[model samples]
Target: MMRIFLMATLGTLTAFAPPAHAQQAGETRLVVRPSPAVPATPTPDQQAAVLERFARARDNLVALREGRRSVSDLSPQELQDVLDYDRRVRGDYPDTRGAKQQCIDDEFRRAGGRPSALARQVIALKCRN
Candidate 1:
């Protein structure tokens, strides 16, 4: 008896309820699918291309640091507005290749030939290779 009452009440409530806009007007709602959160991995060829580009950028950085090359010599097509990128890279790594080696040697001497965790992290950040 209770089950029947519940069923009847449910039916009455549903019957009296106003129809949803789409259902009432017989209109179809368009749904737009969202893009994937994670981007697709690069192909081998794409990876190689990126590596080569970075290698070129590294060479450019070295040349610019040593005063052997000018910003105008950088290929705009290969690295767009490369001067800014070079500046940022230089800012992050203030030391040149020789300076970095000297820094590492000094750090080792300062640590008394036993590098601590902080020293290791410093070396890693200051030295590229």
Candidate 2:
């Protein structure tokens, strides 16, 4: 009777142990789907549109960083402008990489102040509020 009880307890404990295939220390299981084919190339009009969009997104980011606009304060036009800018910049603006960050730094410098902890806090609060 004692041996039977010990065997049953060990069996139950082993049964509840995590499965070996569940996950491994350095292995990640990712589901991959085939991405749709991209167009051969963007046309001239598409290029121009992309440039314009980048400029607009840069402007929006600047405004947001400088406390000129809030997340909730954007109008439909502003939202569309920012979205268009994002798509264009991501698709086009290789020359103006980090343009928004540069603009923010330039504006901060031009305003006769450096970006401080307080300024970042203010921007964060303004963005959230």
Candidate 3:
């Protein structure tokens, strides 16, 4: 048990330590570099498609909140598309953060504190973007 404990401790230390070569070179820190390749701009058609998906997802969320639809009625692809688009846009447009957060808050309230799985799904689709 003592040997095992020592081995585990040594392994943990080894896993976290910087590369041996870096240590030898007198470097104690790691440098992180951002990606060099910029993401490709979306074409007009692609942008339109994303907007359409967002609209559909929002409509579905509203229907769900109103009890006019069920979770099964929600489109996973539509939710994912809007979320992915939002992820990209939020990074580029910091000004949108406030609007997006407000949307999320409204949706959460509309979900009635997520009393049901369907309510949770509605909030995710409506405001997770």
Best by TM-score: 1
Report the error of model 3 at residue 24, Å: 17
Candidate No. with top lDDT? 1
Report the error of model 1 at residue 77, Å.
Answer: 3.5
Question: Regarding lDDT, does 2 or 3 come out ahead?
Answer: 2
Candidate 1's residue-wise lDDT over 29-49, tens digit each? 788999778977999999999
Local error of candidate 2 at residue 75 (angstroms): 5.9
Q: On residues 1-129, what C-alpha lDDT tens digit does candidate 2 reach at each position?
A: 999999999999989988788756887779999999986798899999978866777888779879998868877877877766666656855456365566555556754776678876654454441
| RMSD of each candidate relative to the true structure | 12.7, 14.8, 19.1
Model 3: which residue pairs collide?
Answer: none
**69 Cα displacement, candidate 2 (Å):** 0.9
Arrange candidates by lDDT, highest first: which order?
A: 1, 2, 3
- Candidate 1 yields a Cα-based lDDT of 0.76
Q: Is candidate 1 or candidate 3 better by TM-score?
A: 1
The clash numbers for all candidates, in the given order, read 0, 1, 0
lDDT of each: 0.76, 0.73, 0.72
